[model samples]
Target: MVRELLLAHGNGGEETWTIIKDLFLKYLDDPILSKLEDAAVVPLEGHIAVTTDAFTVSPIFFRGGDIGKLAVCGTVNDLAAMGARPMYMTVSFILEEGMSLEDLETVVRSMGDTARSLGVRVVAGDTKVVPKGTADGVFIVSTGIGRVVYPGLSSHNVRDGDIIIVTGTIGDHGACILAAREGLDFETHLESDCAPLWDMVEALLKEGVEIHAMRDPTRGGLSAVLHEWARASGVSFVVDEQSVPVREEVRGLCEFLGLEPYHLACEGRMVLAVAEESAERVLEILRQHPLGTNAAVIGRAQKGKPQVLLRTAYGTHRFLEPPMGELLPRIC
Candidate 1:
């Protein structure tokens, strides 16, 4: 078998079969996927949530994760934010010619490990190759299908007095990626906070916490999630700047770069709008979990114009703007 990917590997001939059997199937082998059919067949009932995403991070590997892990977590987290239990996935790859098979295997292995940990099955997949320099080393596109475990969680569901909760410190993933790409020399290393959130979110639902809205701040980060909810719910938001969690490393890097930490992305954290009555209990539950140890009530939803008001710790106020354009392109 060729150690470097070639265009013929995607020709749907013997070379393709060799990779499918020896590489992709070797790691992601499941009954459905092993069938090697054009499409996947699985039984899905009840309210199902489906999401698809394409990842093209500049570097395929980074601190705490690689493109493969990002692909799985990104898709799984989308379903989780909707209060769903992720179940099945379809992954496709766009491989650039001359890419190393070893690197490709590393990505596939990461994807398999992540999916297996979450009880998700990769039921279908496809691969295509392009000439070198025409594309990144590898770009992954994934689709996830999940069962809606809890119904009616939406940005529009936030009501007045709903307490906003963050699952963890924000912007770790974004900062980590930025530092890695910039080759910044720092005493403390930054790592991506990229992980699946279904377990934590499921814990909240199981504990009877009433959640109105949940969003994983991705491209535009926590700031984006809050501003979007404010508009969708037709209610203003008041966030205490001090209460919102930000790691020192992340804040330092943002300040050094003249960027706002809140505008950076977080791959694993969740922002929740919960009922005021359940605020403290939610905090108690979140605090007990490993991922939610830093969870805090950043603000509350109120009846006002749709906007996010930032209440500085020094008794000052300002509007937190949503992200514009690409702050850091491909900082996934």
Candidate 2:
């Protein structure tokens, strides 16, 4: 069954790696970051962070990025969230047989180009080929190692009154994927805003800002990441709906699909908790970056039930909960 499933491009739900409780993770605990965060905190006597991720976004190629670019940016962003300076990386590929060599080369070149853009290096890698149709066209697993610029930091540092700032417009990446996949039409030439955010993070850190927590809003989107933080920190978050950034096109699409963009996945957005005094400075630094030009201070952590509340523009309030199921399957 495994072999037969691997030979088909889109098999019946057999490609996911929900086996996260396997033995490999059990051995890497404690100082090695077996905690299973996006990146591991490799305390090199000095401060360093290591993170790894696997990209299985269906379609492989998208409007703004390909698998290769996603691999590099995804790993880099993990380090950024941890207040680290990304230095090196290792990439591995699991390719399905029958995928064109030309397509693979394009992906590889894209990976290299993006790494250079971030001033990081792809120092190592491995490759394996599965029978065509058995795997997605390609699967990439990337590991990144970096030096933590902030020694006294962890997502646990977040607290009440700290400001919540988002890097840029939400739902762009998710909308781009939907448009590309369903061949939807849109007025603006919408594209996935996938890119490395280490530089932006580094700039914010350099300003001597005290950040409580940081996370790249990926798989589960803003609500997912925020709820995770709320549960971990035992605090409530009140987000102003009007303050959250969502493009008009994306809003229209979400309304049509009966989906909430806040629950949609984002590849290029980061949620940050900053000390109230430094929130403006952080926003200034984020705005200086091309990717974070739409950055905004959306809300603040509060002392209440550990839940996310959304204050609608019409004076109505609603709770934004974690996404119940796959909003868009195979969507990164």
Candidate 3:
């Protein structure tokens, strides 16, 4: 019986099979993954959306979710932003020696649970264990394949007069990770917003909303997305700074830390550009979903030089620069 991960488990010998058959299969078993082939065989049709991500969040276990959950959600959200339906995923684990089997199992369970909830199948995977101190406790690399249902979603699709909508309050994940890593204490609670977003995207598609472009505001956060959209679409975004929702706790923490909320990461939130006529319908559909209760239109696209302009409540405007130089390292 395996008590702890060993280097032999990655040597492609009996120990590797034992771990694959006993540990991984026990949790992520499915017809595709059950094949145990060199590569996953998946049938596809229509446009395809493929994405990959690696999760090395410093604290693997955080308030709202763990690295495993982040792994699934990150990949799924990438596809969802492109108007695709997430279908299959392959997850690889890099484990540190002497790591507790219980902790490994806990992470695996969370991965399985998140995948199942999203109707995404684990099609293949790999595992490798390194000597302790050579690596963090664990790191997850996930590759996802999705079928695109709505076509023409692109950063270049944003047009003048388009409205920008954010799915929810920003920076929850970044703040949670920062607070946990720094061991900060506050009366208000902060939790990561790591979650699957396909359901919310699908709702918008079903309503026939005219989605011009979409993205999940992750590492570089809302600032990064807005800057990218402005540059790619060759337009300027005039944002109402006050209309951009920031949770009181998050705002307080950002102020104390001298961090801009727009520059912080959000795992579950999405930034979307849609036709002005479809904006309200899209907002109504988003609010109907539990994940989008806090959705709001924060800005409008305009014909101008490529830049994001933030107008504060005081009628002052400034260029919101693109995030640079690793705001939060190892933040998923």
Best by TM-score: 1
Candidate 1 lDDT over 1-332, as tens digits, reads: 56899999999999899999999999998999999888899998999999999998767898889999999999999999998999999999999999999999999999999999999999999999999999989999999999998999999999999999998899999999888888883555788999988998898889888999999999999999988998899999999999989999999999989998889999999999999999999899888889899999999999999998899989899989989876988876
Off by more than 4 A, model 2: 1-45, 185-188
Off by over 4 Å in 3: 1-3, 185-187
lDDT of 2 by residue, 74-188 (tens): 8999998998888877766787866765676677778877887787866555456678667877889999988888766666677999899999988888888887777784445
Q: What is the lDDT of residue 222 in candidate 1?
A: 90
Error of 1 at 65 (Å): 0.6
lDDT of each: 0.92, 0.78, 0.92
lDDT against true structure, model 3: 0.92
Would you estimate the TM-scores of all the predictions?
0.98, 0.85, 0.97
Task: For model 1, name the residue pairs that clash.
Answer: none
